[model samples]
Target: MNIRKKVIFSFVILVAFIISISSLSMITTYHMKENSSFAKQVSRLINIQEDMNELINLVTIENSLEKLKNIKEKFISFENDFELLREDITKKDHKDLIDYILPNIRQNQNISKSLNNLFENEHAIELIFDDIYKFQNKHIYHNDLFSKIYPEENEKRKLLQELIFKTTNLKLIQEFGNLRYYSKETLYQHRDMETFQKWTNSIDEIILELRKNDRLKILPLFTGYKETVEIMGNLAINIHNIEKEEKILTTKLIKILKENRDESSSIEIKIEEVAEQFLSKISFIELILVITIILITIALTLYISSKLTSIIQKLNSGVKRLKDGDYSSTIVIKEDKEFSEIATTFNNMAQNIEEHQNTLEEKIKLRTNELQGALVNIQKQKDILENLSNKLAKYLSPQLFESIFSGKQDVQIESKRKYLTVFFSDIKGFTDITDSVETETLTEILNEYLDIMSTVAIKHGGTIDKYIGDSIMVFFGDPLSNGKAQDAISCMNMAIQMKEEMSKLRIKWQKDGISKPFHIRMGINSGYCTVGNFGSKNRLDYTIIGGVVNLASRLESNARPDQILISSETYTLIKDTIKCTKKEELQIKGIAHPIQTYEVISSGNNSTIIEEQTGFNLILDLNQIDKNNIINILKNTIIDVEKNI
Candidate 1:
């Protein structure tokens, strides 16, 4: 019986020991899970808090009172979440856990209160902005009404003064006063009070001005209205402060509740002690059983850990190789059936990765080649364009090229030299011809004439300097070698050619049933002159300069169709090559001295001179000449020219 009782007691003790070990293991696992859950919750709360803070900062930077109000509503919602978290903590069975979490909850509550206060302050400022807007409207209406009564009252002045007063007062009393008393004390302490004092002085000056204005008798009413508005602004700010303070108090209360909910240390300690007492009750029976169980458990644990560690080490090595861009590496563990399957999956994944990596590398290489080709083509195109621009520069005179390339709209060339020869030629009766011609035909005709003249000028070593409407300005030398005498002779020869060419052109026109006469005038002069690039830095032009150039133009103005006139110097130079007739010395406009002029009588070739009183004839008195005789002379001259041709 004694042996049987001892055996039964041993059996009971073994059962109790087994129960204790199992309970301890379960408890440890539960504690670990609980802690992990709490940590994740805290992390989530922190992220939410950070997001809220960023939103608040955005609203503050914008100074957007409307957005601030919206954010305030969101803050209220966040506060509710804080309240719920606090309540959740309070309801938790584990008080020890609550203690660990209370501080974070309390911090979140404080942040919410701070944001609420910021919103209230911004709202108060918005009220002041509203007052400024109303004042502006009032000033606008006042100015409009006043201007109608006094027509020249300078109502704008009054409006400006009122605007200054209102803005200064609002900035001082509303913006500076409230923000200074609060924001400055907290954030920026160095702001000067002198600014506010100056604002008040400015308001007094505005009042003095208003009193001086006899037409504005309602100054007292205006003053009273302004005072009331200021009072209202102050009252609004005060109420906002009170509300903010109330929110802060409420937040503090919530923080206290969170603290109460988080008192878990004592409970955790008691639980541990209870577990220890229960464990001690089975200590004697558990000693031998625990030794044997521990030996077996250790051996099983080491064996399993070794297997797991081997597989884990292989996976870690594979991951490292992947990080190093070795997609060919793979994990392989054959210790157990489960691990073998995992290894197989890992090897398959490595193969896929290797294939994908190769494809990606090939695609990258192709894309790089394409980009390189495009870059080469773009560079080649840029080079070609640069070459074209340089070639175009050769056709332009230096002054024109500088104006175009240097980004100027116009070019001017000025010269200090006293003497220059100038030539001006125009298609005679161009306006009358164009009146019956189509616009396209007219443009074509003008382009043809310009092309011919340009070719003639270039052939004679002359510069086709400029075109003014239907006229041409030609010079002997510019941006190249000087050929003044040679250019004059060549130009005379070109004029003779032009007259011959025009006769044929006229015949063609008549055959085509056109009735407009095509005649041209040629003028030449040589004297001291100036020339160079001239005008503002923004615009410049290259042309001959001086009184000599002007006189040449005057001589051109005096010439008639099919006629070429020259100054005395030009006549002397060309007398050996061409025939000429001396004309009487005549006084030209804007000239202090009279100039001797002559006509090119002939080209010493087949060219004939048509005498029709060519050039401005100052010798004949218009008042004394008979109109019928003049008409008869003109008719006879045309018949004579036709016969000569």
Candidate 2:
């Protein structure tokens, strides 16, 4: 696991150890309290039983009422002590202990009370019996004396003895409820009352037998003897009831003690089990804690020591190797830690030093080789430069080549919107001419024609843009220009000169075994166009683009062979310097409006079209035609036409 989980696990184990110890302690404490409580309650019960036994002894021995009262008071004290202890008992180790013990305590108290009542009833019976016995003895003594004085009274004395014998035998009657009450069986209904009434009738019968017509009936003590017997019968009934109640209470007390013993025994067993479990848990916790501490100590020590020592040793070895000039040696310590970073840095340092050494060696060798190769490379470059120079001169005008090579033109990729006179021309019917001419003758004628046109274009400072098969695209007013008027004039001059040159080339081609005539169409438009080195960085073309270029191409496409068409914009710029004829407005694609164009009839004092068509004989200042119409034109025209016609 990761460090976080390991730490949490360690913390959990420690907490569990503490909890185990605490739980053992709590278990021990609870049992201790429970044992103390059970012992106290049992002791109270034993003490109560002992006190009750003492009270029973007193009833059987001294039978003193005061002694009985004191013994009963001691039992009450036991009950009070039990109550107080019950209050003190808070921990319920055996949750049902009170439920099990309380009724028993109550029963024991009832038994004590029953025993006390039994003693009282038995004592009263004894007193009554004693009085009856004493009265019987005195009557016997008087009977014996009277029997000696009159032998005939002996029958009455014998009857008296028999009656006394029967009355005394009443004590031998066993109670019916005694066996039933102890066994929790139902008692005969009203058994005590029945026994009481039967006992009272027996005493009445004995007294009646003594009172039958006899000479001894006149004795004054005989009435007291009868009253004593009646009292003794009542006392006997009370004694029997009390004895029956005592037996029941004794049974309940025994049952209570038995149940108390069982419950206490159960609680003791449970406490023993808890103690055993606590001990086992404590032992296990101790074992785990010991093992965990030992393992963790060893593990942490090894981890920290091995990590720190191994990484440091690797680093030290790397440093020693570096000192020994083994700069190429690398330190590799594989671990998921910061040591990996240190090793990486060490490796990089070693690599840098090694690279520095290798670089120094390489630089020395390169310097030597460069010196040796310089002469041969110089001669080789001279030949290559001469060939490139010839090729560049063939493709570019001297002015364009100078501008670029001298750094006057940077040749960066950029475009500018400028009003430039764009020129386009193509040889008409060159494909058919090529079809009719031999390849060698065709090449000679094409080259001768291009060379002538290029010379004329360069003379007028026109930039030769490119050649498309038999077509030529050139532009002026860039790289060098006097003004718009001058640039337009130069472009028109170039077009006219190229047309004149093509006329001579056509005648020359025919003379040199050529069959067909070659003609050229030229189109020129002056407007805003974007001009720049337009292409990828590796290969660029100094070119122009925009609607103006397209319009120029369209003008070229529309021009008849041997005709040079120019837009109105160019026409206006060089109208005074070059002559032109206004043609129909031509519709060109990509242009919103029709273009006003003119045919270049001639250039520079070549054209003359100043005659007016209207009939007139007035002295007209025709220079005003180049300016505006004179006001006398209408009157002169009417009279002169009428006279001259």
Which candidate achieves the best TM-score against the true structure?
2
- Candidate 1, residue 62: Cα displacement in angstroms equals 88
**Could you give candidate 1's per-residue lDDT for residues 329-418 as a string of tens digits?**
777776656666777787788788878888999999999999999999999999998999899776655445665677753344444573
**Compared with the true structure, what per-residue lDDT tens digits does model 2 show for residues 123-174?**
3433433333333334344334433433322243344445444334443212
Each candidate: RMSD to true structure? 25.2, 58.1
lDDT of 2: 0.64
Best by lDDT: 2
Backbone clash pairs for candidate 2 read none
Cα TM-score per model: 0.34, 0.36
